[model samples]
Target chain A: MIHVDGLTKYYHDLCAVDQISFAIQKGEILGLLGPNGAGKTTILRILAGFLQPTAGTIRVKDYSIDAHFLEIKKLLGYLPESAPLYHDMLVYDYLDYVANIREIDKRQKLPRIRRLADLCGINSVMHQPIGELSKGYKQRVGLAHAMMNDPEILVLDEPTSGLDPNQIVEIREIIKKIGQEKTVILSTHILSEAEATCDRIVIINRGKIVADDRTANLKQTLSDKSRIDLTLQNADFASLQQKLGTINGVDRLTPIEETDHHLRVSISCQGGVDPRAAIYRQIKSTDWILLEFHQETQTLENIFRELTKES
Target chain B: MRQVLPIFRKEFRAYFVTPIAYIVISIFLLVTGWFFFTTFFLFNQANLRNFFGLLPIIFSFVIPAITMRLIAEELNVGTYETLLTLPVTFLDVVLGKFLACWGFIAAMLIPTAAYAFTVAMLGQIDWGPVAGGYIGALLLGAAFSAVGLLASALTRNQIIAFIIGVAICFSLTLIDKMLFFLPRYLLGIFAYLGADFHFENIAKGVIDSRDVLYFVSVSFIGLYGAHLALQAKK
Candidate 1:
């Protein structure tokens, strides 16, 4: 578990992370979502013991970052955005080095390195120079290095940045699997990825935490106005639109497309009502074949844009 | 101490894998060997007097060239973040890198022993002076390397590290010669603090504790400055 209080990091006159406080529970997958220059990486760096906050306190597993840095570092693993790898070292060699530096016992180092390499799916690249590998392989190697010592906390900065779509999904699954047992704080700008992978989301903007809540709760809170799309055959377009507009919950109805036999309409509802039943009753009296009706819920992408834009 | 050893081992291995250690040793042997063949053989000196006397001047440039990339390259490539975030302390990282460079200098010196062997084979070489000269050269190389490491820590640019290292080493080595241009009252005191003053004393077949202490102090100061620089960043 990690606790950060009043964490403000200033580089001279510029504040990178400003007075942000958040606590992460053990075994929680916390997604730090923000656009570029949104202080996500800065917050992660301060928590990882790489940067000293100008005015704040960070505690990792009850060890103060200021007083017990070595112990705190022993409990946390940080993977920077760039993967900070030695180009000339082989994958195994680099992990071995990380294991040794993390103070894993000499006897356990090899076994741990092998286990992590297997877990991160980097076994085939173990003997190859890291610089020679592709971006996906390199990111996996970085993840392996972070997991080499099996630290209790993992702080990853944009772990899926440079990978292809398939690689991103694989890496996200790996991170989720790892998060099941360890505390994970992952920083990313991709809203969908965070929604798919994290247990809770913390949206940051301009060096401040704008929103923090469970993914489902956040979607529910913002899904007040739902839109329903309907397609019909042999429907009177103007009559259907006018009739649907008169329903109690239906706020607006607009024709999306019209053909000789088929008409597509989008209906907006007010006050979180299900307008499909009312629309169905109104169209029952008309000579129209109702083909499709589906409600559109609010997505994490829309909520992210709305929240970040408010800042 | 446990963390220091792994860092030391990795840094030592890095020098070998990156061709830095090899190039340094090869250049040192080639240049020193050339100097010996040309200066001593042509002049026909029975002792390795010229060879040992010239080592400090050679080390002034060679040691810095070897140590310029020790920490600066890590900063340049952003690996310093990885290094600092580990459980290792600042002292562990500094000592590990310092010892690695010292090890490389030692390895480079090993081949130069052949020159000592050649001189011993050719004449009645005084083992005392030869031993003294080796010690002096090793200390001088270490001091130069430490200063270079400090300069490297001040910047993330390896080229800038190399240039500053060379400049510092040149100034330290040539400071004694600059005494003639200084005010007469301060000339002796300034010369006594310069590297050449102390190195010459050690190379004269004598183990002066004061001269030994001088090299140790200089090395300590340089490494201490490097430690402070890294600590400031953290």
Candidate 2:
């Protein structure tokens, strides 16, 4: 439902968002994962029509952002990072004001608000001053504000930042629920949150999209090198390296650590092959006692670290 | 116009939600009341000319205080993004906020009618000039509040907005006073542009379209400047 093309945003001499393009299908939950200063927020802001792009165009449902901004904005609901709120107003009053501004019908405002409050788990704190509420409740109120119009596209920037683990889980679950009916785009530095919440993950770094695919696919494609860790007793470093070096799938072997009684080594295997059985046969032929031999699969966290960490 | 109503409602009620509207209105009444009463006894006049006369100066400060937080606070709290990203036009937001602040000033002026009533009871009072003076005060407040809104839109700092609002309003009001230092050719222009130049006729119960147009033009320029500032941010 949203197509961004060559979007570039510059703040004076500094480029906040480089020329980047991506499309989000309707009812898809897309997570923008990036480290700090990765231009994730900048991209989200442009998509929400808050900031004009220095170059290129954003189109929602075939309407361009510059020409049909009001129409596009009507369909977009944005919750900025940190959930900036009016501290003086009560939660109910704030959401009501947002709903009014969103131009919801007067007859439906109360019902819509109640429904959103229940969905966001903020029904009990409706009458409390937003300033008096905890951070989690405040964020829930912000979510209700963003969803006031029942927008077709919801753009949230760091919706779970600064919340506790339980609050994070609650918000993730709420976003997951909302994602069932709406096109949701959220940005976060937390990889687990993105994996848990988003169907497709767009990993951004230095204002560029380095990886964009289905969450599972990204993990599968980026993690190509499998590792086998071995701990052995009464085995010399040279013998262990010489024996494991000639194995068919072992690409690289390096001793991790060694002591008088024990030695630890890791085998970098190629082509997703498990060389544990071959190594086990080799260790059985010798008198050296094998303490541990385990094969490790690549994790999503490893893929994230490999792609985003600075070379 | 319909979209502006929500912003107006929110902003207008926002004042009362905090102690700001009450405090500002109370201070305004107390200060203006003191000036009106003391000038009444000193000048021994049955007219409200002195009370109306001090408004240009009184409102130069008061209106800024009311309007300084309108846009600046929204920017500081990051609600500006949410508001602008909505379906409303920039004009709607500006007009709604301008009207709300102006409406508060109008509401605050409602109590000052008692000054006129007291003067009428104490002595012979002409209602025409009193009515005209109140109209002039409203227009003056509108003009100052517009300038204040423009300043508020220019910055995210409320104090800076207040200072800029006061500086612009004060300078415009006193522009005519610089006529002695200006060349003779610029005298008429300066006089015409002075914030209170058109207000004198209105205060004296002489309502000219020229004076009305002058206040409207100044207010239009201020509101338009505010609108442009909003666009520049994007």
Candidate 3:
């Protein structure tokens, strides 16, 4: 539904977004994962029409960001980072204003606001001033503002930041529900949140795309290498390495931690190898007491860190 | 154009959501009221000429104070992003805000009509200039509001916006009065540039198209400047 090509943005002489490009399909929950100052917010801002790109074009269907921004804006609902809404207006009044601006039918305005308030779970704070609401409530209100128009595309920047675990879960659920039919593009540094909600994840670092794939595929690629942790009691590192190091696929074994009578060592193997069975048999023949034996599970969090980590 | 109404309503009502609206209106009334009555009894005049004569200078300060927050506050609070991401265009935002400031200025002028009523009750006051003065006041308010909005758009700091707005509006109001400082050759041009000069011409009850065109042109120029400043922000 959306195509971004060579999108570049510069603030004076400093480059905020380099030559970056990506395409998002309709009904796909796309998550942009990056650390601070990684141009994630800048990218989202340019997509939302809040900032003009220094170069390149973004096309939504037949409308282009340059020539038909208003039409593109009509199809987009954007919530800026931290939800900087007008604080003085009451939540109800603010939503009403947004409804009016969205040009909803006069008869359907109140019902629409009510439905959004319920979806965002901000019904209780409707009469209170937005400035007085808690951070989580304010975030819910921001979500409502973004979805007020029920636009085809929703762009949210760090939608779940600064919320409690339950609130984060609620927001994730809301995003998931919205993602069932609408296209969503949310940016965040939180790996688990992205893993939980995004169907396709794009990892960006230093204003560049480092990785882009489905959630499971990102973890599947980590299978080429694996590590096993073994805690051996009464066995010294010299003998453990001398025996485990000679295993067919074992690359290296390093002592992780040592106690008076116990030793913990991690062994790394390469090329989709499993040296655990051989190592276990070798330990069985010895008089060493085995305390624990398990292989480390690879998660998307590890891939995210490795992809976006500073050089 | 239809989208301007929502923004206009929100901006107009936001002034009352805080105490600033009441405070600005009260201060405007006190200052103008004080100056008008003090001379009202001294000259024993039944006409509202003195009240209308003092409006442009009084408005030069009060209008800025009212409009200083229009764009500056939104930029400071970062709500400008949310406002722009909507379907509205830059002209819609600028026009909505400009109209809001002008509308507030109209509300401020509403209370001063009592001054005309009292003057009429006291003596034989000519309604011709009185009506002309009000029409001119609305035009002047619109022009000044546009200037204040441009000033507000030029900066993110409300205080700086207020100061810049005051500086420009004050110059426009008093420019004709300072013609003695300029060279003799530039006197005509400077006088014609003075907002007060054009304003007084309409206040004389003539409703001259030249004077009306002057206020309308000022409004257009100021709003256009604000539009350019906003577009440059991105």
Candidate 4:
């Protein structure tokens, strides 16, 4: 569990993390969605006890980050955005060193290291030096280091960044599996990744939390305005637009593309309106052939862009 | 205390994993060996007297080159954040790194014992003075490493760290000799504070507690400064 209240970090005059407050329950995967410089990394650093907050408080499992840092640190695993690693050391040696520093028992450290290496899929490269690994492998090794301690709280800053599509999916699956057991706060600009992995989403814009809710609920709130795309053959574009504008529940109608015999249109409709039926009847009466018509569902990307836009 | 050991082990092991530890020791031994051979055989000296005299001057540059990357490279490579995020306290990290550098310096001094053996074989050796010289060299190395660690903490550029470290060590070594222009009272205090004054006394095979205290105090001060800089980074 993590609680951040009125948390603010200032670098001279610029506020890195403005007065922001959020609480994450046990075993919850909270995605911190934000653009670059949205203070997401700063929030993660403060929670990990690496950066001291200039104002307010952070409580991890009832222990304040400032007052009980050692206890909180022992319970938390932080993977920074850069994945700071000692390049010259071999993968296994580096994790072994981390295990030792985290104070895991000598006898237990090797097995735990092996388990984490396998979990992050870096077992094959265990004997290779970290500097020689590719970016994807390096990222996995960083994740492996974080998981080595088996901390209850995991703070990952851009866990899927710089990975190829396949690696991203693999990391997403690993994060999903890990989230089932630990409290995870992952910050990422990739909206779809967050949508796929997180139970809840927290949208941060310009150092503030703008939206915090269940991912499904956030999508549902934006789903009221339905979108329909219509491609027509042999329809008069001007007259069709005017006639569709007259429909009661229709909010807006805009022609996307047009040719000699075909037209593509996007229609916005209010909640509970089945504009497809009306459009079908109108097109049939006009003697136009309906090539294709489909409703577009609201995606997390669309919602993310809409919410983070300048307001 | 428990956390310090792991950091120490990791840092000490890093020296061997990379070429840094070997390169530093090799260069130092080569240069010091050259000096010993040139002084004893070419100049016809019978003892390692010249070798001990030249060590502080050599360490003034070598120690910084060895220690410049201790913290600076970590910060540059972004590993500082990883270490800081661990449960270890600032003091533990600082002491562990300082000790690692100290350990490397000690290892470097190990091969120089051959020079001591060579001197004993060629002449009537006074073991007490030879022992005193090694003790003095260790203290000097420890002090230089501490100052270098502090300088390393001030920047992410290891080259800049090296330059600053060398500047600090050079100035400390030169300050006492340059104090003749100052008034009597100030010159007296400056001479006592300067490293050369204490190091010279120790090089004469004297185990004066005052000189020992000075090196220990400077080392403590340098390490403390390094700790503060690291804390500010957080």
Candidate 5:
């Protein structure tokens, strides 16, 4: 539904969003995962048509963003980071104002507002002043405001940053539900939020995309080497290393600790290899009783830190 | 044009949503009323010349306070991003806010009609100048509101917008008054630039094309500057 090609945005001398390109499929929930100053918000802002790119092209549907931004904007529901709202207006009034601005049909306005209020879980505070509401409620109101016109594409910049854990869960559930029908793109520094809510994750660092894939695929593909933890009885470090080094898939072995009668070792295995059986046979012949053997699978959090951390 | 209406409605309604519209209008009426009544008692005259004369000076301060928050508050609160991303041109946003601020100022001037009625009841008052004076007040308010909006667009802080707006309007209000201090050749140019000069001419019921054109030019330049400021984000 959205195609961004070699997009670059510079704020004076500093490039906020460097040359980056990505495509978002319809009805897919995509997460822009990055830390502060990683240009995740910049990319979202460019997609929302709030800022023009210094270079390159963005097309939503068939229309180019530079020439047909208004049309693209009509199809997008953008909730900026922190969701700046009119403090003087009530939640209901604020939504009404947004609906009017979005140019919703007069007859459909009330239903649309009510539906959004419900979906955003802000129905209870509809009459309260937005400024007086809690941070969570205010964010919900912002969500409703964005979805006022029932836009086809939803672009949210750090939607759950300030919310409490429960509010975050609630918002995640709401976004998950919304993603069933709309093409959703949200940016977050929270890895767990992205893992739980997004179908695909794009890791951006220093204004460039570092990795882009499905959450599980990214974790699997980035973790080419696997490590097996082993604890053995009556085993010496040198003998155990010599034995494991001869195995076909074992790349390297390091002794973790040594007790009087037992040794614990971490074995690094080459990618796409399982040497557990060979090590089991070797250990069976040595009379060194195998106490524990487990392979560690990489988590998304580890993959994220590895990709985005100082390199 | 259609997009301007929603923004205009929201902005115009926003004035009353806060205490700003009521407070500004009340203060304006009280100060202008005090000036008019005091001069009426002192001069024992039925004319509203003193009232009209005090307005351009009053607007130099009042209009800024009224318009300072129009674009400045949006920028401060980060609503400018939301407003700009909507399916409306920057011109629509500028025009909508300008009209709302101008409309508020116009509404504030509505009660002053009583002063005109009272002057006629007390003695013969020239309706021509009275009508021209109201027209002049509207034109001056519109022009000052545009200038204030330009200042508002230039800063996110309301106080800074007000200060910049007042500085510009204050200069225009009194620039002609400083002509005596200038060299002989510069007087005409300064007088032509002075808001008071055109305001005075229209207040006298002459309705000169030059004065009308002056207000239009000032208003256009101010609004155009504001439009450019809005588009600078692009």
Candidate 6:
């Protein structure tokens, strides 16, 4: 369990993280979604005991970050952005060193390292120097380093940044597997990563929390802001708008583009009701050909853009 | 304290694993060997006095080179963040790294024992001053390494850390030679401050507690300064 209150961090004149407060329950995978410079990494760093906040406090399992950070540190396994590990050391040596520092039992150290190597998929490159490995391999080594102690909480800052798409998926799968038991807090600018992996999402912008809710519930709550896109073969805009205007939930119909053979239009709708059925019934009585008609619920990507719009 | 050993072992092994340790040791042996043996026949002395004499100035540069990358490289590569987030404390890091650098200085000194051996083979050698000289060398190495670690912790740039470390260690070694230029009344304080002055006293086979305390205190001040510098970043 983690509790953060008024966690503020300032880099001299500029504020990195404002008075942000959030709590995470045990075994919850909380995704911190934010654009660049949105204080997502700052919040995670403060929680990991890497940086001291300018103001406010963080507590884990009743132990305060200010006074009991060493204990909290023992509870956390942190992977910094891009996984900056010792470049000169061999991967096996690096993990062995981490295991030793974490005070893993002398006898259990090798077996534990083997298990983590298996979990992170880094056994093949175990003998290679970390600098010689690619970004994906370096990140896996960083993961093994973080999980060496098997800490209860894992804080990853942009774990998938600079990786290939396949690497991203692999890292996400690893994170999802870890999320089954441990408390995992990860920050990412990628919207879909949050949607696919996190149980709950906290959307932050300009050092402020804009939205915080369950991933499913967030999209469900904004489902009322839906749109029905239509591609009509023969209907003209004036008559089609006139005919669809009578539907109760449909707010407005706007023409998108007109081709020689088809007329494309987007109908804006409000309320939680599905206006697709009524619109289809209205079209069923008419002679217009329905080439394409699909209602798209507001996705997390759209909601993210709405909350943290471009400046 | 318990966590210090792992960090120390890692840092120590890291030096040997990378080419830095070999390069530093080779250069140290070359410079000391060339300078010490070149004057060997001219002085015809059985003692390692010339070798120990060159150490205060030589170590001023050598120890910094040994220690410059200790903290600066970690900061530059961003591994300091990873290391700090572990369960270790600041003291754990500083002590571990300080001991590793000191241990490196000891290891680097091992090859120079051949110089002492060659001297004993050539002529009658007084083992007392030779023993004292080696002891003084270790103490001086520790003090300089501590100062270098402080400089390394002060900046994320290894070159700047090396330069700052060399500056402080060189000043400590050179201060005694400039004592005549100072006002008569402040002479004692400046003389006492010169690192070379205490190191020479110990190298004379006189293990005075004051001289021993001087190196120990200098090392303490340097390590403590490094600890404060790291804390100030937070």
- Candidate 1 residues B119-189, lDDT tens each? 88897777887788789888998898889999889988888888898888888888998888999999878
5 against 6, candidate with superior DockQ? 6
| Candidate 4 CAPRI level | high
> Model 3 Cα displacement at A154 (Å)?
1.3
lDDT of 6 by residue, B1-234 (tens): 789999999999999998999999999999999999899899988989999999999999999998999999999999999999999999999999999999998999999999988999999999999899999999998899899999999999999999999999999999999998999999999999999999999999999999899899999999999999999877
**Candidate 1: regions farther than 4 A off:** A227-270, A276-296
Q: Flag the better candidate by DockQ, 2 or 3.
A: 3
After aligning candidate 4 to the native by TM-score, how far in Å is the CA of B153 from where it should be? 0.8
**Per-residue lDDT for B1-234 in model 5, tens only?**
678888888899999989998899899999999988986978877788889999999999999999999999999999888777667788889999999998998899999999999889998888898899999999999999999999999999999999999999999999999999999998899999999999999998889999999998999999999998878876
On DockQ, who's better, 3 or 5? 3
lDDT of 3 by residue, A182-280 (tens): 999999999988889999999988888999999878868877667788898999999888888789889989899988899999887787778878988
Runs of candidate 3 exceeding 4 Å displacement = A230-239, A254-265, A283-294
- Highest lDDT: which candidate? 6
Model 4 TM-score, all chains together: 0.95
Quality of candidate 5 docking, DockQ: 0.64
Error of 3 at A79 (Å): 1.2
lDDT of 4 at B65: 93
Give the worst 10-residue stretch by lDDT in candidate 5 chain B: B81-90
Candidate 2 backbone collisions, by pair:
none
lDDT of 5 at A196: 95
Runs in model 6 deviating more than 4 A are A230-246, A253-266, A277-294
Any runs in candidate 4 off by more than 4 Å, and if so which? A231-238, A255-264, A287-292, B41-45
Candidate 3 per-residue lDDT, tens place, B1-234, comes to: 788999999999998889989999999999999999998988987888888899999999999999899999999999999999999999999999999988888898899989988888899999999899999999999999999999999999999999999999999999999999999999999998899999888788989998899899999999999999999998
Q: Give the winner by lDDT: 1 or 2.
A: 2
Fraction of native contacts in model 6? Answer: 0.87
lDDT of 3 at A38: 92
lDDT of 2: 0.89
lDDT of 2 by residue, A142-214 (tens): 8988888989999999999999999999999999999999999999999889989999999898888988999
- List of clashing residue pairs for candidate 1: none
Q: What is the C-alpha lDDT of each candidate?
A: 0.86, 0.89, 0.92, 0.89, 0.90, 0.93
Candidate 5: docking tier: medium
The residue pairs in collision within model 6 are none
